[model samples]
Target: MVLQRMGSVKVASATLVAALAVVFALTLMKGTYSFGGFWSTEAHRNRSIDLQLFDAWSNPTLWYAPWLDAVGNVALFIPFGFLLVTIVAGRWRIPIVFSTLLGFLVSVGIEVAQYVYAIGYTDVDDVVCNTVGAFLGACFARILGYRGRGFVVTLFLVGALCVLAEMVLSVVF
Candidate 1:
């Protein structure tokens, strides 16, 4: 019975992982130049992060409409890492270091696609943010068992709490 349960989990995980990989691959391959209706113009370069249009990072408040952009980027890749740890084979559970590498590879691939297909620029900031988001997702799986309902959901909530807590910390302490 125990073995059968594990086998089911393995199968389910594998299927989920395969599906995620395919979606990710296709998304990366397809270059949509008019994504978000905001990235259409290349004139946002003058909006500096440090000096000109700074937001209260400590507050976790949205700086312009870009807060949605950041959240969107972070939320987009959560499933990749989740699928990695959950469905990957026994010896192939994605390690943190490997996850980071995967993030970098994905970021690179996206940037390359954008450049080759004339969709987006090769921004270093995007790479850093993406890698961080992926890691957070993978770390969620690692700390939690990665397969199951109760604990996995708890992990996701806790992870969000941590991110929120960080912002709260910035303000409180």
Candidate 2:
């Protein structure tokens, strides 16, 4: 019975991971889904990288922009870390570090793609925000306790709730 439950948890974890991948792709590469060529033919591309960390604060009128973007980026990857830790069996540090590194690499890749495809501009702030988000997410997973049947169940429930919230928000807006 225990083995059967574990197997089911593993299956659920895999499914959640797959769903995450799809959501991530859709969210990041939304511009690619438009009816256009493979590469954007825009004459101008934003390749400049803004190293100014607090520049987002300079705009007094849009004060919330920076805060929102940072928080949103972090919130975006929390699930990635949580789900990753739940699925992988290892020390807490392993998943935490792995998730952080993965988040950074993925963010960098997305920035590069955005620049190359002329879909969006690359920003160092985004990379920093994403990494921090992933780190927090990993910490959250650790807080929930790592690598157990209960943890797996909790992860699935939390993920489902998050998905439901997202769906509700999308429908409302």
Indicate the TM-score of model 2.
0.65
Q: How would you encode candidate 1's per-residue C-alpha lDDT over 90-161 as one tens digit per residue? A: 566446656667866886687566555554344555666677777776676677663452344334434544
Per-residue lDDT of candidate 2, residues 43-72 (tens digit): 223445566775777774455767776786
Which structure among the candidates has the greatest lDDT? 2
Off by over 4 Å in 1: 1-62, 146-173
Number of clashing residue pairs, candidate 1: 0
The regions of model 2 sitting more than 4 angstroms off are 1-19, 32-48, 91-93, 147-173
Q: Provide the lDDT at 85 for model 1.
A: 57
How many angstroms is residue 102 displaced in model 2 relative to the true structure, after the best TM-score fit? 1.3
Go through the candidates in order and give the C-alpha RMSD of each one to the true structure.
11.1, 6.7
